[model samples]
Target: MKALMTLALVSTMAAGLAGCVVAPNSGSIYTSRQAQNEQTVRIATVESVREVRIDKGNSGTGALTGAALGGLAGSTVGGGNGSVAAGILGAVAGGLAGDNVEANMKRHAGVEITVRLDSGELRAITQDADELFRPGERVRLLSDGRKTRVTH
Candidate 1:
C-alpha cells in the first residue's frame, strides 16, 4: 500500500512538471533626440516600421526536478526487468513534462523598422524630419550639411 501511494505521488509530480516555455512579445520603437541643422530642407523617407515585443515569462523548474524524482521512484519500484522498464518510462514522461513547461513559458512577438535617406543638396534647416512618422518606424538620415535631412 505504501509503495503504491509513493508511486502515485511520483507519477503525479512528474505529470505536473512537463510544461514550460515563455512566448516572446512584439518589437518596439527607437528614437533619436539629435537636432537637424537649422535651415536645412530635410527630406524624410519611410524606411521600415513594425510592432512591439511581447514579454516572455519564465517557466517553472518544478518539471525537470519532478521528472528526475519520478524516474528515481520508478526505478526503485521493482527489481530487474521491472526496474529498467520503470526508469525508461520515467525519463520519457519527464522529458514530456519539461517540453510542455517550456512551451507554456514561450513568448512570441517582434517587430523591425528600417529607414533610408536620399542624397541631394538644399538648405540647412530642421524641417519636419519625420513627417508622417508612424510609431515603430525607424527613420534614417543622410546629410551633406548643405541641404536635406534624408530620412529613410
Candidate 2:
C-alpha cells in the first residue's frame, strides 16, 4: 500500500512538472525608438479576436514516469514470477494511460489575432492570450527569422 501511494505521488509530481511551459508574451518595452534588426516590425490594425487553443505536443515524460510508478505498484501485488509478469503488464498499461492524460493536460489556452497590415495584407498569429486585445486596436507585429508575435 505504501509503495502504491508513493508511486502515485511521484507520477503526479512528474506529470505536473512536465506540463509547465515558459512562453513569450507581449509587453511594453520602453525604448528610445524601435531598434532595427534582421527582424521586421510592422504596424497593423486588429481585425478580429478569436479564441484559440495550442497543443504543447507531448514528449513522453508522462509515459516513462508512469511506467516506473506502475511497475513499483505491481511488484507489490504478488510474489516471484507472478510479480514480474504483473509489473511488466502494469507498466505498459500505466504508460498508455499516462500519455493520454498528459496530452489532455497539455492543451493550452490562446487567441488567434487577425490583423490587416498597412500594405493591406491580412495575417493571423496565434499566441498565449494572457493580455486582452480588441478589434480595431493598433498593435505591432514583430517577426524575427523564426517566430512572430503581436504586441500592443
Candidate 3:
C-alpha cells in the first residue's frame, strides 16, 4: 500500500515537472524580451531547408524531482540499513532516468533555412520547424541584430 502510494506520488511529480519545460523557439513565438522590440526586416529567397533537432538542454528540475521521489519510494523498500542503500541506489538511477526523460522531451524538431538576401549575401537561420520553407520561395528575414528568423 505504501509503495503504491509512493509510485502514484512519483508519477504525479514527474508529470508536474514536465509542465516546466521551456517553450518552443518558433518564428511565431517570442520571448518577453523579444516582444515590443523593433527588428530589421529584409527580403530573401530560400535556397534550401533541412530538418534539424533542437535541444533546449536540461534545467535540473527533472533530475532533482526524480531523485527526491525515488528516494522516498526506495526508502520504503526494506528496513534499516537495507532501506538506506536502496534509497541511495534509487536516487542515482532515478536521477539518470529523469535527466534522460527531460532531455528527450525538450528535444524538438527544427529547420535549417539557407537563404539569399536581396543584397546577394547568403545566410542560414535555424529555428523550430513551426513553418515550412522551400527553395525558390520568397521569405522575410527578421532580425534584431542578434537573433534572426525566417518567415513567409
Candidate 4:
C-alpha cells in the first residue's frame, strides 16, 4: 500500500513539473533623423542614431518534452529503491536541456541604415519649393538624363 502510494505521488509530481519551464521574450526599437540647410552657405552636418533589443532565455515547450522523456527514462532505470530519486533528477536535467534548446532556436532580428553626403557647391535661386514629406510615407529618388527628383 505504502509503495503504491509513493509511486502514485511521484508520478503526479513528475507530470505536474513538466510545465515548469518559461519561454524566452524578445523586442526591438528603431530611430532616424534628417535636416535641411540654406544653399551656397557653409553648412555643418551632425547626426545621432541608436538601436535597442531585449531578450529572455528559456522555452516552455522544449522543457516539457525533455522533462517527460527524462522522467520516463529514469523510471525505467533502477528497480525499487532508487527509481524515484533517479526520475526526479532526470526530470530536472531534461528541463534545463530543453530550455537551452529553445533559447538556441529563438531569434532576434535587427536592421541598420547609413547614408553619406559629399561636400559640393550649389546655386540658391528663388523658385517654388514643396515640403510634402510625412511620417509612414515611402520616398524614392529617380534620375533621368540630367535631373533627379523625388518620385510620386
Candidate 5:
C-alpha cells in the first residue's frame, strides 16, 4: 500500500542519515587532507589502554530529514484541519526522535591510549577502537600536529 511504501522510504532515509554520522577515523584510514602530508612518527610503548566512546556531535541532518518524512506521512492521517495538526505533531516528535537517533549513531567505540614516548614523555591519545593495543606494547604514534593516531 501507499502507507507501507512511505514507511519504507522513511526507514531508508533514516538509515542513510545514520550512515552519514560515521566517518573514517580509524588508524588505517586516511583523509584526503591527511594524504600526501608529512606526519611525525615516534616510537612509544603503551602504558595503558581504556575503552572510550567518541561522539562527533550532530549536524542537524537527521532531524531535518526525519521531520520532512514525518510531516509528509502525518499529512495523510486525516481531514484538512486535523491533518495539519497531525503533521505538526509528527514533525516535532520525529525531530526529537531523529536527534536522539543521530546522537546514538554518531557515537563510536574508541580507546584512550596512554603511551610513554622514547623521549620519556607521557601522552594519551584517543582514537577509534579499530586497532588493538595492549599495555607495554610497542606502537607507532603518527602525528601531524593537528591529529594523532596509534598503529602497530
Candidate 6:
C-alpha cells in the first residue's frame, strides 16, 4: 500500500520533470523583461521542417519507483528469511525495468526548423513539435542570449 503510493508519486514527478524540456512552447510570448534582455532578434524564412524525437535523459526517478513497487510485490512471494531475499532481488530487477520504461516515455516529439535569415545566414532550431510550421513561412527569431525560438 505504502509502496504503491510512493510509486505513484515518484512516477508523477518523473513524468513532470521529463515534460519540462526547454522547447519553444507554441505561441509562447516573451515577457517585457525577456524582450529587454534579448541579445539579438531576426526575421527569417523557414526553409525546412523535420520531425524529430528529443530524448530526456534519465534522472533515475523511474528506477527508484520500480524498485519500490517491485520490492513491495516481492515481499509477498515467500516466508521469513526467503521473503527478505526475494524483496532485494525484486528491487534490483524492478529498478532496471523502471529505468528502461522511463527512458522510453521521456522522449518528446519535436521538430527541427531550418530557417534563412535576411542576411543570408542559415540556422536551425529544434523544439517540441506540438505546433505545425510550414516551409517558407516568415517568423521572428527570438533569442535571450542563451536559447533561440521561432514564432509566427
What's the lDDT for candidate 3? Answer: 0.85
- Per-residue lDDT for 1-152 in model 2, tens only? 76666867686757656554434443333233334456688999999989988788786777777676677768778899999899898889888877787787778678999999999999998887777789999999888766677888
lDDT per residue (tens digit) for residues 1-152 in model 3: 57775686677587647655686678889988889999999999999999999988888777777776777768879999999999898888888887777778889899999999988999999999999899999999999998898888
Per-candidate clash tally: 48, 0, 0, 0, 0, 0
Model 5 scores a TM of 0.85
**lDDT for predicted candidate 2 compared with the true structure:** 0.76
Model 1 agreement with the true structure over 5-81: per-residue lDDT tens digits: 57776665665444343221211212232334344333444544554343354444545555665676678778899
Error at 93, model 4, angstroms: 0.2
lDDT of 6 by residue, 29-117 (tens): 55555655735678999999999998868878778777877777787799898988998898899888988887887787888999999
Q: What TM-score does each of the candidates earn?
A: 0.33, 0.73, 0.84, 0.38, 0.85, 0.75
Model 5 lDDT per residue over 2-92, tens place = 6775886677687656657556668889978789999999999999999999998888877876776777778789988998899898888
Error of 1 at 151 (Å): 16
Write the residue-wise lDDT of candidate 4 on 32-129 in tens digits: 21113211322222121123232334437667666766766677688786988888888888878866766655534221211112343221111112
* TM-score-superior candidate, 5 or 6: 5
Better of 3 and 4 by TM-score: 3
Rank by lDDT (best first):
3, 5, 6, 2, 1, 4
TM-score, prediction 1: 0.33
List where candidate 5 sits over 4 angstroms from the true fold: 1-22
lDDT of 6 at 21: 45
Candidate 6: C-alpha lDDT: 0.77
